[model samples]
Target: MPLLESLVKRRKNREPLSYITGKAEFFKRQFSVDERVLIPRPESEQLVAQTINYVRKLGIEHPRIADIGTGSGAIAISIALEMPSAEVFATDISSEALKVAQMNAHKLGAEVEFTQGNLMGTLQGKFDLIVSNPPYIQSQVIKSLEPEVLREPRIALDGGPNGTEVISPLLEEIRKKLKPSYSAAYVEIDPPIADIALKTAQAKFSYAEVSILTDLAGLIRCISIENN
Candidate 1:
């Protein structure tokens, strides 16, 4: 089959458009993506934007930043490129996804330290900022999703029961990684259970403030946690 024909066939067979094109964009920058990682979505841009703004407001020169579950290196790489002074790290549970993320960091010429481990497992020491866009879809909802979305890796979508399986645990792990004060985490959350995720984060960081942020659609899109 001709190359374009093969590409069209793949899309017709329900391959994600990003996988077919071998690219996805976040924060106005393009990235290479495949079955190993989740496609970067526009709504996630809100997380990135808010993080950058918070970092600037904090005015902490050379802030240490980490991107949890940084599939495709979208969030980490973008922030590294945007904040030349900040040290950046990215982690993923899938080695394959890390390979793609590393490749993207090189292609984009962004300096991001990469680690392979589940959630906060590979991380040590404190970071001034941490951000993530983890799996948030309930198992049952995932089963009923469109074939196009289903084409993505299940690990990147399955949030287990109540859609808080990953997010809830991650909040506790995140609190431990933070720098205690003036540290914050920006998390991209699915709207369906944003409240649940925020509550969990707050519970984990009782001294911290967890706020829900909305995207242009006025739907819950992110949870910002700042430890005052």
Candidate 2:
């Protein structure tokens, strides 16, 4: 068919299929995606699962959650839909990405407040749970990445020279934003930065529990900070 031929041509040209189709699935739900937003990945589902489990484990009746760099609003929207009583807020620096996220939230009927700002800087008050999938890929590595990946927004993938550019500051900021107790934060990271993440979190939360969580493929993918 003409559509199939066009899709094949796009694939051959290294254009991400998700962008070509304008859709990407996340947390078992289909989300509208375009070049403006990075496509959601399965690894991020672990971030969402861990966040939800943390809330249920603590038995928080009304938890305040924040999702930074919420590209497609997948994590925030999914959490809001799962825990209807919880207050969920998502932030992104890109207005275009936020537009896609807001559209998805409206389409899914997920009650998530989307804000435009830098990371968690826009959020006020302490949160019971905070989660983010900040850009963790090293700047140099990004240039050598697959062509399909290079097509994604650079701001959503580049983590500066050392790859901890966003994460380091985020950990520092999270300590101030999270509740003193019974609060936690989950952040996705590249495998190479696992040690750096652990070190940063340990330094930030001396008394809190810090651990690295692995994805289904057994790759270190998330840094978990529990302010117990």
Candidate 3:
């Protein structure tokens, strides 16, 4: 009864349920979470599954993977836990967020190297798989989101004027660095701007097979890239 009351109080105050609970479940594992890091969403789990399958198809027994803007190390750690043979690394500009991610990694016993840098700039190698759930919410619509969402860090949500600002440039860098033929990049995108994701990826990775993957709701949720 006390737990239920506390949850009700949190929702009434607009504190995110995940924040109040101090954890979130992703890819079937409990990950410590707080305001310091963006709460992992079920939608992002698809990025992990997609990446695993795509890389496996490439026959990479020990693939290298980088999760850009790894807020709570949910995606990166989850991938690491599942693909024991794979090498996983995560990057985040926020030192606080990195700390939270590191704690979760340690608690979950997943070995994911964390780096402090914006996007993929800090990463040093051409990974067999690169993935991200970059900030894709347009500035104008930020305040219009649910009060619970507003409580999360804006840096993890604001995607600039059109919601694809971060994604565009990130794709550009990935285009130049993705290992030819055997490498791929997966990006979680806003449904409304799925077209922008596809266009940017196609423009940057002209020779890659870029596809818009839909979530269970039948809404476009991710962009998958494979070097052709």
Arrange candidates by TM-score, highest first: which order? 2, 1, 3
lDDT of 2 by residue, 1-228 (tens): 999999999999999999998988888899999999999998899988998899999899999999999998999999999899999999999999999999999999999999999988899999999999999999989878999998999999999888999999989889999999999999999998789779988998998999998887889989999987
Candidate 1's displacement at residue 129, Å, is 0.6
Top candidate (lDDT): 2
The residue pairs that clash in candidate 2, if any, are: none
Estimate the TM-score of every prediction. Answer: 0.96, 0.97, 0.95
Tens-digit lDDT string for candidate 1 (103-167): 99999999999999999888889999999999999888997998989888899999998998888
Candidate 3: TM-score?
Answer: 0.95
The 0-to-1 C-alpha lDDT of every candidate, in the order given, reads 0.89, 0.93, 0.90
Misplaced by over 4 Å in model 3 are 1-8
Off by over 4 Å in 2: 1-4
Write down the worst ten-residue block by lDDT for model 3: 173-182
Candidate 3 per-residue lDDT, tens place, 58-126, comes to 778999899999999999999999999998999998999999999999998999999999888888878
Model 2, C-alpha of 102: deviation from truth (Å): 0.2
Give the CA lDDT, 0 to 100, for residue 192 in model 1.
88
